[model samples]
Target: MNKLLEVKDLNISFHTFAGEVQAIRGVNFDLYEGETLAIVGESGSGKSVTTKSIMQLLSANSEIKSGEILFNDRDIVKAPEKEMQKIRGKDISMIFQDPMTSLNPTMTIGNQIMEPLLKHRKLNKTEAKHRAIELLNLVGIPKPQLRIKQYPHQFSGGMRQRVVIAIALACAPKVLIADEPTTALDVTIQGQILDLMKDLQKRIETSIIFITHDLGVVANVADRVAVMYGGKIIEVGTVDEIFYNPQHPYTWGLISSMPSLDTTEEELYVIPGTPPDLLHPPKGDAFAPRNPYAMKIDLEEEPPMLKVSDTHYAATWLLHPNAPKVDPPLAVKERWNKFQKQVGSLNGGK
Candidate 1:
């Protein structure tokens, strides 16, 4: 697949009265054409920051320390405001976490969707309005022509989210970044939203960067997954690689913590300790403190993202040639085995 966006050694920091907090540290990943790349991590893991940095939507105090956000062979990190304006909502678009906050309650839904078309697509009122209605229907909104005249307050939570998606897809953006778009919805609505996005991606052939803390959601939509910890991408691989052949301890913890359908265990697993404070970032592996299999090297030095396969890589001392091999929790192992068996059965033993 062709690479749509490449983020290389990206570093970002936020200035607070306390000090400069390192929000993203040398994070690297690529978004391929027409594929969904899910960035999975706990809060403050820099998943949102990384994506926001790509969009140039970081807060005023945020600083870009280094790295490149290469999109379509152009560096977005250094692009001027005018250039970013042209790119945003046109070439690339983002659906924020909250539909309530993302939409303008004062504006009609139709106008909200049309705003981008007028600004970026240079469509006149009549043309933009027609396209907006088309987008409204495209995102599964009912009576788009009538609903477009309604304010955001008039829509239900699920409907409002659909409106936000319509707005994001207004200009037929090549890349769509969804930052936990379903976090605020209930399970059923969440599933609907995800299904909607997957359907839209297929129809539009848009590359997506899906940011979420839920491993379960990643399974549904992601072709590839990047696991973040302490402002760093600790693991990057295809979804199956991360799920069934995870190499990093952090990855193991994340997978194990997720509820498994086939597991017989009564107790749910949880990773120990909280994420490290980034204001005074740890010198060693940020996840070392919480890692049960942490070796002395984990506490003394940071590990590089070493290759595990052609498409899989992980940052962990455990993957070092000299380190002892430690098995993941029984739950994780069981889940991996189940996934492998399912794959084997699907292939009819090849």
Candidate 2:
């Protein structure tokens, strides 16, 4: 697969009354053509901020300290606003979490979807209207012709999101960045949206960067996963590798916290301690305070990312040659074993 987008050593900071908050710290990742990469992390993990930087959508107070975002072999960071305007929707599109906020309340849904086509393709009113209805139908929105003329308020939450997806696909963008796209919908609706996205990807072959805190969602949609913590990508690998043989303590915590179909545990496991403050950043690893298996070196120095395999890398002392080998918690081990058994049973008793 060819590389569609590359983010190299990206760092971002926000100027605040208290001090500068270092949000993204040398984050690096790649998105290949027709592949889905999911960025998973906690609320303040800078997952959203990193992707927003790619689109040049950061607030005035936010600054890119270092990095290059290369799209189609061109550096987007240095691209002028006028050029970015042409690329934003035509080459790359974004779908925000809240469809209500993204769509204009006064404008009809048809007009909203048609705007991009008109601007990018220079289609006439009749042509744009016909394309708008087709887009709605493509996203699995029922009664496309009638729904196109309705206002944003007329659509339900899930339908509104469908509209958002329709508008995103208006120009047949090569890449789409969906930031918590299903957060506002119910579980059934969420599943519907995920299925719709998968179907669209199959037909269009668009590279997707899906940003979410939900591990469950990632399991269903992601080809690869990047676990973020304290404004950095601490671990990255294929979805199965990250789920089955996770190396980072933070990644372990996230997987253990996921509700299992086989486990009937009364209480869900939660990671202890809060994320480190960025204003006065930690001298060593930010996750050391919450890590039960933290070594002395974890508090004294930050561990560099160690390669476990060609496709898997983690920033944790556990993978270091000199560090002592310590297994994950007993509960985590038990959960893994049970999950393995279930998988074995499902795959023709392998």
Candidate 3:
């Protein structure tokens, strides 16, 4: 449980014609060695923006107003471009959602993977070429020798993703950020990719930051989960805690919305209302507008993150001592029970 990456009070904003969009507001989390942490939220919830800021990959209009991103005890936020270049692929790497866009269309797969080895490992042409084919094989690509010579367009979507993963693992980074890595694939392919990532993680012992909106995806790959909303984390806890004893309304909605694997539900539950606009952000709790359990205080004041357990924390008035106790929807409770049974079975009924 060694700490690999720490993001403290990280804030990111964008300068647009209309106004400054506060994309990430005081978000905080830590990734431990060989652990997978999933950041789950709806689109525009700052899931991608927060992680992108850590890599200094924000767009030209976006600005890092404040906060510290400490990687390996070094303040990466303050590091120069040259220093970051060395760290990007050597110590930390990212796999974007669309592999086709991320990969160079004109470059051969072999040359693309070899680029990192040549830049970071200082490998000669022959050495880099040999390692490139080895990486392709490592990612389960068939006929690595012939495949390496082909262009990206020659591969299928799933195969292209394997190439993207190969590039990310080429440098053997300590931390890997996967931003919706399996979003564009079919369900079966998505499961295979997720399993592959887990298997690779076990072999390499690398910490991963998995960003996605799919709770089902988180269930398989994540050790811990951070529930985000309106540019802030509303709940942070272990996978079991968040799944079994969720405290935030947002977290409850997300769990209830998950397509049940055990039950026959015709339609999936969707959270009501839309995410709040960041231009003129709410003065109080940003989620108040969409929260079904909102109280009078919820519209006038924001709640601080309350400690529910040693490792679990949630930002909601429902956890306050003076507030009346409430229960989540029946559907959510049912899902929690099913999830518990699954976990128990996996742990040999412990």
Candidate 4:
């Protein structure tokens, strides 16, 4: 696959009244053409910050300390505002988390979807409206002609999300960034939206950057997964590798914390301790304090990403050649066992 977007040595910070908060620390990753890449992490883990930077959507208080965001051979970080205005919705589109605030309640759905078509494609009103209805229909909205004429309030929550997706896909962007687009929906709606996105990708041939803290959500959707923590990508691998053969301790914690419906346990496991303080970013590994498998070296130096496979890499001292071999927690092993058992049963007990 071709490299569509590449982020190298990306460092981002936010200037606040308290101090300069380091949001992204030397983050690096790649998004290939026609693939879904899921960036998973907690709320403040910089997943959104990194994706926002690709769209140049960071606030005025934020700064790109140093790095390059290469999209189609163009450095987006250095692109002027005028150039970015041309790139925003036409070249790259984003489906934000919340649909309620994302849409203008006053404007009809048709006009909202047509806004991008009018601004980017320079289409006439008739042409734009035609395209808008087509978009609404494409996203599985029923009676596009009548629905487009109605306000956002007239539609259900799921319908409003479909409208958001329609607007995002209106211009046929090369890249689509979905920042936890399913976070607000129920499980069934989430599944429908995921299916819709995968289907749309096939039809449009657009790369997708899916951001979420939910590991279970991306299981069937993502081709590759990047695990973020303390404002950095701690591990990255193919979906199968990350879920079946994780290397990072933090990754193990996340896997163990997944809520299992088959199990009788009602209390979902939580990763203990708070995330690292970025205002005074740690000198050593940021997750050292929280990592049970951490060693003396973890507190003294940050570990570089060690290659586990051609497609898998993780930043942890435990991956060091000289570090101690620590076993993953029993809960994580049990979870993996349950998954394997389920897979085996589905395969006719093979």
Model 4: runs farther than 4 Å from truth? Answer: 264-267, 337-350
Off by over 4 Å in 2: 261-266, 333-350
Local accuracy by lDDT, each model: 0.90, 0.91, 0.92, 0.92
lDDT of 4: 0.92
Candidate 3 lDDT over 218-295, as tens digits, reads 888899999999999999999989988899999999988876556566556788899999998898899999898999
lDDT digits (tens) for residues 213-315 of candidate 4: 9887778689999999999999999999998889999999998887665766665677889999999999889988988778888888888999999999999
Estimated TM-score for each candidate: 0.94, 0.95, 0.95, 0.96
Global fold similarity of model 4 (TM-score): 0.96
Model 3 misplaced regions, further than 4 Å? 261-267, 336-350
Error of 2 at 95 (Å): 1.0
User: 1-350, model 1: which lDDT tens digit per residue?
Assistant: 89999999999999999999998999889998999999999998999999999889999999999999999999999999999999999989999999999998788998899999999888999999999889989888889889989999999999999999999988889999999999999977998899999999999899999999988789779999999999999999999999988989888888777764455566567788999888999989999899889889888899998999999999998888899978767878765566555546644765
Q: What lDDT does model 2 reach?
A: 0.91
Model 3 clashing residue pairs (backbone): none
